[model samples]
Target: MLRVMNERAVFGEIFRLGKVSRPELAQATGLSKPTISMALADLERARLVRPIGLRTGNAGRAALLYEIRPEAGWVLAVDVGREFVRLALADLVGDIAARGDERRKGGETPAELVARLGELTRELADEAGAALEDITLTVFGTPGIHDKETGSLQLAPNLPGWERPGAIELLAGVVPDTPYIVENDVDLAAVGEGAYGLGQGVDHFALVWIGTGIGMGVVIDGKLYRGAQGAAGEISYLPVGEGDPLVNRGRGMLESVASADGVVAQAARLGLEGLTSAKDVFDAARRQDPIACQVVAAESDHIAHALAGVIAVLDPELVVLGGGIGVQAGDLLIGPVTGRLRDLVALRVPMIKASTLGTEAVLLGAMAVGLTTARDLVFERAVAQAPPG
Candidate 1:
C-alpha cells in the first residue's frame, strides 16, 4: 500500500512538472532515491509514465527525465446545444486528438441524436488513431439539470429528447465501462473560464449566460456549486423582472424577459419593426435605431433586475456574461447592465466581463470536467498495475 501511494505521489509530480528527473522527483516528493526508482519502475511498467529525455548539463552523471504518457488516458468532451453538437477527443496531456462540430438538423429523436453522437465519436476516434474503447471518460456539457437518481435531464426545453428518461443513459455507453457525465452546459462554461478564460484563479464567480436561453453557473471556493437539487444557478426562474412572472411560467420569469426571444419580443413590443432575433435588435441598436435602443435598454433592465437578485443571493466576486447575446452584444450590455446593477444592488458590485472564449467555452469546460475525473481514474488504473500491490 505504501509503495502504491509512493508511486502515485511520484506520478503526480511527473504529471505536474511535465518532465522530471528521478532526483527532482525525489526532492519534490520528499522520497529517497530508491523510493523514486521503485515508483518510476511501477509507472513505466504500467505505461503511465516514461523517460522522455535526459537532464544533462549537471555537475554529475545525467539523470533521465520522466513524464506521464500522453496516450495513457483519453477524454471525450461533447457540447450538446440547441443548434450544434460538438465532440472533441483529448489525450492525457490535454492535446486534442480529434474534433467534430456539426450543426444539428432540427427534429431528431433522443435515440437518433444519441446515434449521431456515437457515429461522430467513432469517426473522431478513427481520425485520431484511437480505438473506440480508448476513451477513459466522457463529459457532456448540456443545458438543464441532470438528475442522478432518475438519469433524466430537467429544464432542458431546447433539446427535445434530452430530458427523456433514457436519453442521457445512451451517452454513457459511448465509451468503455460506461464512464461518462452529463453536466449543465453553463456550469461547464464556468469551469472552462476557470481553466482558460476570464475566471481563471477566481475563487468565486458566476458565468451568466443570456442567449436563446438564460441561465447562470456559479463557482464558489473554486468548485462548481450544484445546489442540493443540483439547480444552483437556474437564474432564469428569478421573479424580479418586469411583467407577470407567470406569463411564461413554462420558460421561467427572467428567461422569458431576458433571453434572446425576450429581446426580440421587447423589440416588437417597443415598436421596432422586422427584428426577428436578438442579434438583429443589437445590430439595429448599434446602427442607432431609436426603438431598437429602447429594446436594448428594456433588455438591459430585465437582465439587471435578474442579476441584482443573483448578487443578493450568491454574492459572486465577478460575473462573466456569456452565450450568444451576452457575447455579441456584451460590450453594449455590460455598460448598461453594470450601471443598472450598480443602482440595483446595495452591496459592493462584482466585476462584470465578457467571455473571452465565446462559443468554445462550454466545450472547453467539458474537457476540463472530464480531465478531472480522467486524471484520477487513470492514475488509479496505473497504480493498480504495480506488481503485488
Candidate 2:
C-alpha cells in the first residue's frame, strides 16, 4: 500500500508539472531519494514514464529529466456528422499523430457507415503504427443522445437506421476489450471549447449549436451536467409557442423554428430569390436585403426565446454559439438575439460569443475526452501493474 501511494504521488507530480528530475520530483512529492528511485524504476518498467533529457542548469553533474512517455498508449477521437466522418488519432499526452476525414454518401446504410468508421479507424491506427487492440480509449461524437439503456442512439434522425436494435452493439463489437464512448457532437463541442476555446476561464457557460439541428451544451461549476438519462442540455424541446408540449416531443418546438431548415424555410416564405440554402439567406441578410433581413430577424427572435429558457434554467455566465450556421452568421444573430433575450429573461443576461474553434470544435473535443479517459486508464494500469505490497 505504501509503495502504491508513493508511486501515485510521484506520477501525479510529474503529470502536473510536465517534466522533472529525480531530485525535483523528490522535492515536489516529499518522498525520499531512494523511494523516488524505486517508484520511477517501477513506472519505467510499466512504460508510463521515461527519461527525456539532461537538465541543463545544474552544477556538479547534469541530472536526467523525465517526462511521461506520450507513446505509451493511443487514443482515437471520432466525429460522426451528417455529411462527414472526421477522426483524430492522438497519443497518451494528447498530441494528434494522425487525422483523416471522409464525406458521407447519400443513402448510405447504417452498416455501411459503421464499416467506413471501422476502416478509417484501422487506417489511422496503421498510419500511427498502432494496432486496434492497442488503442487505450475511443470516443465517438455523434449528432444524437446516446441511450445507455438500450445501447442505441436516440433523436439522431440524420444518421438513418442508427437507432435500430443491435446497431450500437455491432459498432461496439467491432473493437473488442477497448473502452469506447459515444457522446453528443455539440456536447463534445462544449468540452472542446472549455479546453481549447472561449470557455477556458469561465466556470459556468452554455454552448448553443444551430445548424441542421439545434441543441445546447451546459457546463456548470467546470463540469458537464448530464442530467438523468443524459438529456440535460436537450433545450430544443423548449415550448416557445402556444402548442402542447406533449405534441412537440420528438424534435422540440424551438428547434423546429430556429434550426438551419427553419432559416431556409423562413427565407423561402419571404420570397427571397436564388436562396436554395441557408447560407444564401444569411449572405442576403449580410448584404442588407429587406426580405432576407426580415427573415434573419425573425430567426434571431426565435433563437433568443430558446436562449431565454436556457438562461432562466442554468443562469450560465457565458453563452457560446457554435455549429455551422451559428458561428458563420453570428454577426447577424448576436445583436437581435441579445436584445430580445434581455427582454424575455428577468435576470442578467450572459455574454454571447461565437466559437473560435469553428468546425474543429467537436474534433478537438473528442481529443479532450479521449485524453481524459486515457489518463484514468493509464493510472489504473500503473496501479495494477505495481509490485505486490
Candidate 3:
C-alpha cells in the first residue's frame, strides 16, 4: 500500500513537470529522499521512467534528471473525412513524433477508407520508429455520430458505405487489441479548441464547423455534452430554413443553405455557373462579383439564424468558427452573421472567433483524447497488477 502510494506521487509529479531530479521529486511530492529514491527505482524498473541526463545546480553535486520514458507507449490520432485522412503519432507524454496526411481518392468506400487508415497508421508508426502493437491507444475522428449499439456510423451520408454494418469493427480491426475509439470530427474540434485554441479558459463554448459538412461541438462546464445517442451537436437538422423542414430531414434546413454544397448550389442559382468549389465562390466574392456577394450574404444570414438558435439555448461564452470556409472566409461572414444574429436573438450575442488551429484541430483533439486514454489505461493496469495489502 505504501509503495503504491509513493509510486503514484512520484509518477504524478513527473507526468506534470516533464522532467525532475530526485531532490526535485522529493520536494514536489513532499516525500523523504529515500522514499523518492525507491519510487524512482521502481518506476525505472517498470520502464515508466528513465534518467535522461544530469541537472547541475549551484550546489554540492550534480543531480540525475529523470523523465517519463517517451517510448514507453504511443498514441495514434486519426482524422477521417470525405476528402482527406490525417494521422498523427505521439508518445505517452504527448510529444508528437510523426504526422501524415493523405487526400482520399473520390469514390472510395468505407471499407477502402478503413484499409487506407490502417496503411496510414503503419506508415506513421514506421516514421515514428515504433510498431503498431506499441501504440497504446488510437482515437479516430470522423464526421457524423458513432452508433455504439449498431457499431456503425449514422447521419454520415457524405462518406459512402460508412453506414454499413460492422463499420466500427472494421476500424477496430486496423489496430487489433489496442484501445480504440471513433469520435465525431467536430466534437473533437471543439475539444481541440477548448484545450488549445480560442475556447480555452471558457467554461461554456461552442465550435461551429462549416465546410463540406455542417456541425457543432458544444462544451458545457468544461465537459463535452454528447447528449443521448452521442448526437448532441447535429446542428445541420435545425429547423431554421424557409424550405419544408420535413422534406429536408436528411440534409437539415440549416445545412441545406449553409454548408459548402449549399453555398455552391446558391452560387449556381445566382448565375455563377461552372463554380467548381466553394473556394471559387469565396474567391469570386473577394473580386466583388455581384452574384457571389449576394450568395455569400444569404449564406451569412443563414449561419446567423442557426447560431441564434444555439446561442438562445446554450448561451455559450464563445462560439468558434471552424472548417475550411469558416476560417478562410471569416472576415466575409463574421459581420453579416453577427448582425443578423443580433436581429434574431434577444439575448446577448456570444463572442465569435475564427479557429486558429485550422485543419489540425481535429488531429490535436485526437491526440488529447488518445494521451488521456493511454495514461489512464497504463495507470489502471499498474494499479491492478499491484499486490493487495
Candidate 4:
C-alpha cells in the first residue's frame, strides 16, 4: 500500500514554487479535484503545508497559494570534531534557527560528548521556541569510520577512547526515539557543500579539508560516493614524505606530508619550534615570516602534488578547499596546488575554490541528512498506511 494520497500532497508542495491552485495540482498529478482537495486537507492537518495568500492570474479571480511548512518538523545536527562540538537546529528548508559550539578536552569519551550534545540540543530547541518532540530526526558527523551495520564509531585516531564499547549505543540512548544517522565528518561536509554551497551546480567535485588531519570527500554525478566499507576518500594515508621507516609507514602516506601535523613535522625537521599548530604557521605566513613562508610553501607543494593525483583520477569539475587551514590559505594553496596539477594533467585545471560555509559545513550536512531521512520516513509511513490497492 503506497500512501499515494500523502505522496501527492508532499510532491505538490515540494514542486509548487508559487501559488498553485487545486486545478493546477489536479492537472499536474492527473488526479480529480476531489482527490487533490483531500490531499491538501490532509497535509494541512499534518502541519506540513499551509495556505499562503492567493495567486492572481485568472481574470481578477484569486486562487489560493500553498507552501510547505518550514517549521512543521525540525532537524538536530551535530558535528563532533577532535577539538570542538557544534550543534544546530534547522528547519526542513535547511535554515539554521539555533547554533552553538563548545571546545573539548582531547580525551573526552563519547558518553561524555553525548551528554553535552543532549544539553545543547535541548537548549537550541528552547531558543527556537520548539519542543524536543518537534525534532523529527538527528544526524551527527564525526571524525571516524561510521559502521552503518553496527552504528558504531571505529578507528578515529584523533580521539582517544572513541572506539570503546557503547559509544553509539550511549548516544542513541540519550537522543531516544529520534531517527539517528552518523557519518564521517569530511563526507558530511561534501554533502553540505553539494546541497547548499559552491558545489551545488557542479556534479563532480572534491572537498579536501586540511586541518589537524587531512581528509577528503568525493562527489560524482551529483552524489556523495562513499566507497565500499566507507573508506573511499581516506586520502590521508597516501604516502608522500620521508621519516623514520616504520613510523613514516605507520602514519600512512598523505598524512605524512599534507595534514596539519605533517606541516608541523616538516617545520620541526627544519629545526623550527615554538609553533603551536598549523594556524600559527598560517598567521605567520600572513605576516610574511620567512620560516612561515617557507614552511607553508613546502606544505602547499605537497598538497598540490596530492591534488594533482586526485584531479588526474577523479577529473572533478571543481576542487573545494575547506577546513580552518584550507579556508584561510585560499589562493595561497590554489596557486601551488593548481600549478602542480597543471603540470601533471594535460587537461585544463578544474575550478579551485574555497568553501563559503566555513567550519559549519559538517553541521549543515547533518541537517540535510536529517531532513532527507525524515522525508523518506514520512513517505514510508504513508505507504505502510495506504489503503490496499
Candidate 5:
C-alpha cells in the first residue's frame, strides 16, 4: 500500500510537471532518490511514462527527464448539438489525435442520433489509428442534464425521446467494452471555457448560452455548481421574458423569446420581412434595418433581464455569452445588454464577453472532462497490472 501511494504520487508529479528529473520528482514528491527510482521503474514497466531526454543545462551531471507517455491512454469526446454532432479523440496529454463533425438531419430521433454516435466513435478511432477498445474514457455532451439516478436525460426538449427512460442506458451501450459518461452540453461549454478560454483562472463566472436553446453554466469558486437537483443553470425556465409562465410551452419561457427560434418569431411578430433566421436579422441590423434593430434591441433587453436575475443570485465575476445566436450577435447585444443591466442590477455588473471557444466549447469541454478521468483510470490500471507490495 505504501509503495502504491508513492508510485501514485510520483506519477502525479510527473504528470503535473510535464517533464521532470529524478531530483525534481524527489523534491516535488518528498520521496528519497531510491524511492523515486523504484516508482519510475514501475511506471516505465507499466508503459504509463517514459524518459524523454537529458536536462542539459543542469549544474551537476545531466538529469534524465521523464514524461507521461502521450499514447499510454486515450479519451473520446462527443458533442451533440441541435444541428451538428462533433467527435474528437485525445491522448493522455490532451493532444487531439482525431476529430470530425456531421450535420444532424431534420427530425432525427434520439435512437437515430445514438446510432450515428456509435458510428462516429468507430470512425474517429480509426482516424486516430486506434481501436474502439483503445479508448480509456468516452464522454458525450448532450443538450440536457443526465439524471445519474434514473439514467435518463432531463430538460432536453431539443432532442425528442431523449428524456425517456432507458435513453441514457441506450446511449451508454454505444461504446462497446468501454465506460461512457454523459454531460450537459452547456455545462461542458463552461468547463471548456475554464480550461482554454476567457474563463481561465476566473474563480467565479457563468457561461450563458443563448442559441437554439437557453441555459447557463455557473462556476462558483472554480467549480461547477449544479443545483441540488442538477438544474442550477436551467435559466431558460426563468420568467424574465414575454408572456405568462402558466401557459408553459415545452421549451422554457426565456428560451421561447431569446433563442434563435425566438428571434425569428419576434421578427415575424413585428412585421419584419425576409428575416427567417436570427442570423438574417442580425445581418439586416448590421445594415441598419429599422425593423431588425428593434428585434435586436428587444432580444438584448430579454438577455439583460435574465442576466440581471443571474447576477442578483450568483454575483459571478464574468459572464460569457455562447451558443449560435449568442456568439454571432455578441457585439451588437453586449452594449444594450450591459446598458440595460446597469439600470436593473443593484451591485456591480460582471464583464460580459463573447465566447472565445465558440461552438467548439462543448467538444473542448468534453475533452477536458475525459482527460481528467482518463489520467486517473490509466494510473489505476497501471497500478493494478503490478500491484505494489
Candidate 6:
C-alpha cells in the first residue's frame, strides 16, 4: 500500500542533492514526466516544497527549481530550568521569530507554572503575528525524567512537587488539541546542537552542561542515545572522591565539584565573601581576583577529570560545553579541561568546543522536535487521504 513512485520522486531528489528540478527528479527517480509532475504538484499544494527560482544554462527552456518549505507551520519550544523559563517560537527552518524569558520564584506550583506558560505563549504568538492554533506542536525541555506511559515527571530534582498527577496533562489542557512533548533539558540541548549548531555533521558527541548542576547528553550516530531507563547521560551521580563526608553524602561526586553552586559553596568555605553566585565568581575572575580565579580553575579541572572518564568510555569525537556557567566561562574552562584531558588520555584527542547556541539550545531543540512531529503528522494525513490501492 505504499506510493513507491511518488515517495521516491520526492525524497530521493530532496535527499540526493538538497534541491532539484522537476526534470531532474523525473530522471533520477525513473518516473514518467506526467507522474513526476503530478507528484510535485501535490507536494507543492501541501506546502512541502516551494519554487526557489528558474535555473539557467539551458539552451531551449529554463527549469524552475524547488526547495523544502520551512514555514509550513510553526513550532513552539520551551526550556524550563530551576531559575527561569525560556520560550521561543520558530519556523520550520529553525529561525526563532519571537523569544522571551521569565524568572521562576520559589515554591511555584506546577499549575501556576503551566498557567504562566500559557500566558507567555499567547503573548509570544501575538508578537510573531501568529495564532496559537497555527502552531503545529509544542515541546518542553525541563530538568526532569519524564514517564511517557503516564505523562508524569518521574524524577525532577529542581522542581519540587512537579510530579503530581496530571502535570503534563494539565499543561496540555491549556492549549486544547495541540500536540505536546516533554523531555530532559540536557537531552534536548544535545539534540538542538546536533541538528542546527555545533554538533552538525558530527555523528558521535557528548554535551556536558555545568550550571546549577552537572549533567550530560550523549549522541551516537546522529541520534540521542538515551539508555534503557531514559537516564543514559545523568553523570551527576558518578563517584569520584572517597571517604570525604561532603563528597559521599547527598548529591553525587561530579556535581559537588563541577556545578555552579558547588563552586560558590567551595569559594565561601575558602574565606571568599561577596561571591553569592557563579556569575559573581566569573566576574571576579575577569577582574583578576585571585580567589575567584582559583575557584573557577579548580572547578574546570574537576570537570576535565570527569570528562576524561567519559572519553575513555564513549570515545566521542567532540565534547561540547554548555549551560549558563559553562557558556559564560567557556574560554577559561576549555584550555584547562583540554590540558587535563591530554594528561589522562594517550590516543587521539577529541575536539573540545563551547556551545554556540548558549541558553537557547534547549529551546531550539524542543522546536525541532515539534517541527519533526508536525511533519510526521502531515505525512500520516497524506497517507490516509491517498487513494485505495
Q: What is the clash count of model 2?
A: 0
Clashing residue pairs, candidate 2?
Answer: none
All models, RMSD in angstroms: 2.0, 2.8, 2.6, 2.9, 1.9, 3.0
How much lDDT does candidate 5 score?
0.89
Q: Please write out the lDDT profile of model 1 over residues 1-389, one tens digit for every residue.
A: 78878987887788778888888888999999998998898888899888888888879899888888989999999999988999999998889999899999968878788888889999999999999878899999888999888778899887777776766787765664658888899999999999999999999999999888888899999998988998989988888566433234578878888888888887777788887888999999999999988888888888888889889988999999999998999878899989998899998989999999999999999998887788889988766655563
- By TM-score, the better pick of 4 and 5 is 5
Top-down TM-score ranking: 5, 1, 2, 3, 4, 6
Each candidate: what lDDT?
0.87, 0.84, 0.87, 0.77, 0.89, 0.80
Task: Compose the digit string of candidate 5's lDDT tens values, residues 257-308.
Answer: 8888888888888888776789999999999999999999999999999999
Off by over 4 Å in 3: 22-33, 57-63, 243-249, 382-389
Candidate 4: tens digits of C-alpha lDDT, residues 225-302: 999999888887766655423223445576667777777766666666788687777777778888888888888777
Candidate 2 structure quality by residue, lDDT tens digits, 301-352? 8888888878888899999999888899999999889999889999998999
Clashing pairs in 5: none
> If scored against the real structure, what TM-score would every candidate get?
0.95, 0.92, 0.92, 0.89, 0.96, 0.89
* lDDT of each residue in 49-144, candidate 3, tens digit only: 899998776678888999988887899999987688888999999988999989989778777877888888888899999999899999999998
Candidate 4: give its CA RMSD in angstroms. 2.9
Q: Least accurate stretch of 10 residues (summed lDDT) in model 1?
A: 240-249
> Which one wins by lDDT: 4 or 5?
5
Best model number under lDDT? 5
* Worst lDDT 10-window in candidate 6: 241-250
